[model samples]
Target chain A: MGIVSPGFSGRRRSGSELPPGQYLTRDFPVLSAGPTPHIRTEHWEFTVTTETGEATKWDWAALLALPADEITKDIHCVTRWSKLETNWKGVSLDTLLADVETSADYALVHSYGGYTTNVPMDDLLDGQAWIAYEYDGEPIDPEHGGPARLLVPHLYFWKSAKWVRGLVLSDNQDLGFWETAGYHEYGDPWKEQRYAGD
Target chain B: MTTDASYLDGNAAAGALSQVFAMDVTAAITQCNGCGQTGVFAESHVYVNAPGLVARCSGCDGVLLRVVTTPSDVYLDLRGLTYLRLPNP
Candidate 1:
């Protein structure tokens, strides 16, 4: 809230629409931690694994066959870029979990590239999230987490793990790939909780 | 392409690094503390996709540098490097 200092001096900001210190990047920047895994839609599957190890799976076609919703939302990244009014289409998690059973209170979202992030189980339900496969009316690009990515717009974009392959329900919370390194456990952008202590 | 599509050389970090160092930090020679491999900072395997910018040693894949810029903070970690010698520019 102080006058723009040295660290943030490099980036531009308007503050009216963005969460805290974020800047609006017209171009969606690709920030990846590892090599991209080439996954075919035919080979893509999403699994929901409970703490008891019970699993329910859905293949690409089956997923598309389920009810889908068109969404327009803003996404904020921990690295400080926010894209607004992005459109996405995907099946709601409420519908996906309708048939699945779980007593766990936490969920650890995992991506195909070995990336994992944790969130409260409640965050995935009641219209809070989706397994988004389409962006801007087109099939989402593989590099953008296509086949599908978990879209949890309320949290930082990283929590919406790209190449999302599964959600592991847990009775206990666990720190994921970035969380273990220092990212906030529950990345609420409005609160500006970007790091461990923040 | 999203920055996620590829890993770039450390030179890609210039604009971001400019926030901290007055000179071009990517031109400095660095030695990895983990594997002891030495190279110009530009040659490190730099992954720009993530919560931050992560540069890893080309030799052993140890993290050579990590830069995370928040709204009000900039975290630069060189723990993976034993030393960095700035080239006379």
Candidate 2:
């Protein structure tokens, strides 16, 4: 668990304790600060375009039918405590990205919240990422990011964007959210990459 | 009855609540048992015991303590309906 120290600047309360590293907030008010990301059914599509001549797309309905798996793990928050038990159900990122033969070396994950994170193709194929829809044995609530959220448990919690909408295959990694705000681009809980300096 | 009346009358009513008393309450620096974040509010305040209180910080989603017991230096969690005594004015 992360220890809350006094004068953590304005980012934390004067005497507030933070959860462990890697776990995202499941609490209130924290999720209520931002604008609700837009969700469009008609315009929504998960597309995978390769360097080749063809591209494949999966609509919302088509996605729900895929083989789903529930992952149980502990998550650490950048503020610092570790949430011991959490569960999420969703399609494997590898399985979803399997059909697309992208010669592009990297990929960009795009979300409805106006956020994006770039990861290498090798990382995507490694099987540690997914599009999560269920949390803690229940359908994800809107405030905690319902419909679908990206879970990259291996990285810091921030990498797992809430209300994720799409993934854009790209040749390079782009910074997202806290990454631009002094947080490490590739957050590693073990490495203590909670803030810019770690 | 006369003795009781005289005893009661010895104490005057606080004039229209217009007087102010300077009071200082100290909050302890503690950590949330759940999240492990530091600086959570204690389980007691100046004159109350707050068990199972929870508060989040604005900056980093950390848990924080809302009040403390000054005399005993006890930390109280600031959850539920704990009340704070205002300074007398």
Candidate 3:
């Protein structure tokens, strides 16, 4: 008969198995606005404005009524925990941008909790990004950022801002919260952009 | 030379609570002065010699605590009994 449990495995099994390295948790207070010129989505609307001036605005209910798709992927946090097989459902950013006609050179992704990330027009238009509304097959909990969030799976988790509300096509790229706080501007998980230098 | 009296709700160590979001250890023990009793604080944790701050007591809701760094551990006295942030294992 084959042995059930291996004695020489030398692996500690438990319900809570932490990922490699120490995980540090910070009590980050959510900020809703910044000194820079920006718009707040709580009172404002996400208007898909075009260079030709045709535009359509989406409110909370109208935004939720859009199509939803499920995705499973690994998420690498800037704090260094790479969670595998996370599932989320939301509208694709590519589909949203397709509805707009933009000649702007760049775009700024605006989010609640007073966060913003900049992307080149080409970069924004190329990725498999989504505005996630559900997590793990249910409505995302408030603590995990409810209402809506931006999921940029290609980059570190911090780039996936919580309570995300709008996207503004601009002619320039601006840095967001962690980006201004010594975090890498382009947080690519493949390159291990966990910090400014690493 | 210290008494081992404890509180019911860990009120003395009220300033040493740490939030256990994922796998963190929360509600560490602390010494209380009021009731002359101490108990396990459920909300506080301490950071030893971190940049800009010496120690933080999450039990007291992000209050700064006294720093007494030793070779083995960082000792923080909540009321009278010491709360130690042990070295990472």
Q: Write the per-residue lDDT of candidate 1 for residues A1-198, one digit (tens) a residue.
A: 446421122333455868998988778887687666668888899999999999999999999999888777788988889987778999899999998878899999988866789989888898889999999999888778887999999899989989999999999999887776567899999999889889
- How does chain B score by TM in each prediction? 0.89, 0.21, 0.23
The candidate scoring highest on lDDT is 1
Chain B TM-score, model 3, reads 0.23
- Tens-digit lDDT string for candidate 3 (B3-86): 111112223223322321122323444443323234444433333212111222323322323333223333443332444333
What are the clashing pairs of model 1? A30-B3, A30-B4, A31-B49, A31-B50, A32-B49
Q: Summarize candidate 2's per-residue lDDT along A1-198 as a digit string, tens digits.
A: 335321112332221233333333454223222334445545556666554536678777887888776676555555454554467888887789776667777666666645566556666566577788888778776656666877777665556767776666656666654454345666677777655555
Q: DockQ values for all predictions?
A: 0.23, 0.01, 0.02
Could you tell me which 10 consecutive residues in candidate 1 chain B have the lowest summed lDDT? B1-10
Candidate 2 off by > 4 Å: A1-33, A38-44, A49-55, B1-89
Q: Rank the candidates by TM-score, best first.
A: 1, 2, 3
**Which candidate has the highest TM-score of all?**
1
Q: Estimate candidate 2's alpha-carbon lDDT, on a 0 to 1 scale.
A: 0.51
Instruction: Output DockQ, candidate 3.
Output: 0.02
Comparing candidate 1 with candidate 3, which one achieves the higher TM-score?
1
What TM-score does each prediction get for chain A alone? 0.91, 0.75, 0.70
Question: Candidate 2 on B4-84: residue-level lDDT in tens?
Answer: 111111012122111221323223334434345443233322111111122333233333332222222333333322233
Off by over 4 Å in 1: A1-15, B1-5, B9-44, B55-89
Instruction: Point out the worst 10-residue segment of candidate 1 chain A by lDDT.
Output: A4-13
